[model samples]
Target: DMYQMISDDNPYETPMMIFPASHYTMGGIWVDYELQTSIKGLFAIGECNFSDHGANRLGASALMQGLADGYFVIPYTMQNYLSDQIKVPHFTTDAKEFDEAEKAVRARIEKLMNIKGTKSPDQIHKRLGHVMWDLVGMGRTLQGLVKALAEIEEVRKEFYTDLRVVGRADDLNTELEKALRLEDFLVIAKMMAIDALNRNESCGAHFREEYQLADGEAARNDKDYMYVSCWKYTGDNEKPVLLKEPLNYTEIKVQTRNYKS
Candidate 1:
């Protein structure tokens, strides 16, 4: 399209490569009004925080969000938390308390290196993207979600067992970094599928095929799912627990959104 715009060629008539993608669909780490996460002193801002937008992010919302957070919001809110830590001492990375933590991280990296697996972190990442897009993205279904869970679990196993890295962990290795990130991404993917499966209702961007109106619109079950779901991670072996905080619309009316209007 950029080429078409600059040149004399027509945009539609010219051959163009296209890639389908979800544009800021519903999902982000939960945070309070001050952009503070459940963990104390930790903050997530802008796109990282799930404070704004209940479902779909409106056009130019990200722009407005960035402006509000960067210029107005976080500067004031973050100070409210930082003022309490004026007397608190900061721990450096080389601190004695970080010894156990550092050891754990090093041990994990060593375990990954010793696996001597065949697949690269990049390869598994692509596979994971496809799995998420096909099974967990857009139109989520019960059967598909269940299948995705199983497939993701298997993929997770494959990562630990047959992974291969280009360089040593102690060196400047992007592959090792990617492997660490992919490990976390796999966890998040599982959580997304679990959230989708448990909801059992279609609301906003989360469209479950089984739950819809006669007019082919999203059908929200306010009675049961009238709340924000908070998932707590227990461990890699155990299922996450679900917590709900009910939403009350005292001033504004809540109802199904008809895009046709």
Candidate 2:
């Protein structure tokens, strides 16, 4: 009865919209054994880093992953890297690097403000949400993925030129922030689309419709795709390069999941 009260189709009486939305991503920024990112002096933990969870994480395990990384893993592993950075002095607000970064941000904000377009960022993002939901949400196919990529690119162009942001760069404007975030979302959307296209097999939550068996179960091509697909940012609107790290299974034999049995 309690379960039925919270489900989409409650046989017991109450019905609700309980379908899965974008909540967890087993795919994330790649990290090494030390939880260190590709960039030195940078580290990622928990859901942000693509570690521990693999491509498919079991339910209720994300909290454990976060706790382990925060309390146990990072404390020990980060010291190894941070110990070498003791000599580097603290940076000043007026430093050249800081100034350059600030300038870049200012330029971006100015561009957003000066767009002078009709559609608001939120409107464009809603359209983006629809695009992702239909093409890359759950059931994916090669043809759908290709179309999604093209549509996402169109969205990106429209976002830059047709965007409307009515706020000052120097002032506290939530709309401006939301607009900037939408820009990032578009970039990430494109990258995800490319990644999905490259991965021909269906493993974990990334189910490619074309890569399933006769029984509609996921068909994994472990021999060819038994490696991590890491994407590196090249430039704005440029294609990302995919690097692989082969997975070696010495202890356990990988097999299809059996939920019915």
Candidate 3:
């Protein structure tokens, strides 16, 4: 019920608090050892980048990655980058680029608010969440995936026409914030669903309904799908770039994962 409220296909009526559903990767910008993103003079450390986790992440490794990047990596890389720039030039808030970026942000918010739709933003968010939780949340199957894709399309249609935002563009509105986040979540949710559907065997968090052992445990087909699937988002209509990063095990021999006693 809680998950439904925050991630339902339709807008939620009662207010609810949503927990972090899965991995958090909002911290990485395009950074070097200095932990900087593509933007010059900007730095990102901790859980923000794609550097640490290679496909399926292990527990407690997040802490190590954060410490390594912040304490060890960034200091050295930042020093190298900063060595050449002795006197840094300061730019005012009214700079042309800054103004343009700010204007763009404001305009986007305005557009969302001005959308005279019948369905509320919460409605679309809930529908998307339901699809993700049911199809790509924990377990998956081909049939579920097909259903999820169809449901997502329906919800997306509602998002553009029925979805409503009840707040001013300039004000600090939590509802508007939620709407924007939902948009990103919807995109990511589909990616996860597709990734799970394409993977035939079960591995790590990806558990396919058709792929399981006789003892009722997840079965891995390492021979066929022992590589990490990396997806790059292209444009809206264009297909994503699919890349493979193979996993070779030397220290730990390949063995079936089991927890049954």
Candidate 4:
């Protein structure tokens, strides 16, 4: 493992090793050139929105993309949005919508606190991580994916019912925050699994066990699966809508992707 290789305890340091963890998100809220989502008021940029990167993200592009979106895109788009909203009066926090939103947030926190569970939130999170790493971590297959989905379902159920937190609701509790973040990670992990499973061919960081070259290199099926898979989250019970945006390669011709000569 990557962690073990990097650790001080390890005698022989390997130059390259697999360190699988919940890293970058390829898909997020759909956005336009202006970084605006489908909702008129909402705007998402950087890693939060699935805009720039297609299937495989290039190195050193993340910084460039984030800066470009933040400095150029957002400023220009906000100007356009604000131009129309200049005459509109600013709403106060005491407004019904704001009050309702606050109430809902508070209620959620209260509900989480009320659950007197035996297992700590970390315990549940560790199990989730193990499940994901075992089945849907590096290379994935149909059997492994199905098993992972079942395990994830069980973890989610345990998380909601048996998870515990140690802190007052008012104060800044790091544990509670971690628990919330872990919950979000769980949802995100599920989406990744679904995306990986649906995509039968291997491409970029997404490597399917069933699709690979004889030498272990990822084989891209551009003719069939050369499209960005954008998933829209509906709700807890509802299935995510899988949207495909086809890649148009005009300048560069389709060629074999290889790092080694």
* TM-score, per-candidate, Cα-based: 0.87, 0.86, 0.69, 0.77
Candidate 3 — which residues are off by over 4 angstroms?
Answer: 1-107, 250-252
Candidate achieving the largest TM-score:
1
lDDT tens digits, residue span 17-133, model 3: 433334531223345556777677777776666577633454456678789888888888887778877877877898899989988888877777777787777778877877877
C-alpha root-mean-square deviation, each candidate: 4.5, 4.0, 9.4, 5.4
lDDT of 2 at 27: 68
Worst 10 residues of 3 by lDDT: 18-27
Q: Candidate 1: where are CA atoms >4 Å away?
A: 1-21, 90-96
Candidate 4, pairs of clashing residues: none
* 1 against 4, candidate with superior TM-score: 1
Candidate lDDT values, in order: 0.84, 0.83, 0.72, 0.77
Estimate the overall C-alpha local distance difference test score of candidate 3.
Answer: 0.72
**What number of clashing residue pairs does each candidate have, in the order they appear?**
2, 0, 14, 0
lDDT of 2 at 73: 97
Q: Candidate 4: misplaced stretches above 4 Å?
A: 1-30, 37-61, 64-77, 250-252
